[model samples]
Target: MRTFTVEIEKDEKFYIAQCVEHSNCFTQGKTIEEAIHNIKEVIDLILHIKRPKLHIILKDSLVNAL
Candidate 1:
């Protein structure tokens, strides 16, 4: 598992959560708990998308080597 830094701040009416490593990764919620939950969901989604590509790359490399 990989670790990332999350930064949380309040803006007007919502708490915004952002990943320090990924500028484009961010989410907002009414409370800190909600914001954290939402950010986890977002990170899961990102990893879901990236995981498949990584698997594909590894598969291709192994196939090429064989």
Candidate 2:
């Protein structure tokens, strides 16, 4: 089993979670926890069906500089 890190972002309306190591896999929910859970489900589905090897670019800065 492989471990993937998921990055989550929340706005006023919804939360979006995406895997840092996988592109084209993402999920949205009403809250952070929900988003994380939904993203996990998406990951499982993708892995089970397609088993794709996703390569994502690493970003050094997570926040914008003001």
Put down candidate 2 lDDT per residue, 1-66, tens digits, no spaces.
Answer: 466777766556877778877788888899666876677688879866334333332233323311
RMSD of 1: 15.7
Best-matching candidate per lDDT:
2
Q: Each candidate's lDDT (Cα)?
A: 0.64, 0.65
Clashing pairs for predicted structure model 1, backbone only: none
Our tally of clashes for model 1 stands at 0
Q: What does the lDDT read for residue 21 in candidate 2?
A: 70
lDDT of 1: 0.64
Tell me the spans in candidate 2 whose CA falls farther than 4 Å from its real position.
49-66
TM-score of 1: 0.68
lDDT of 1 by residue, 1-66 (tens): 566677777767887877777778789889767977777778778755332111111123323545
User: How many backbone collisions does model 2 have?
Assistant: 0
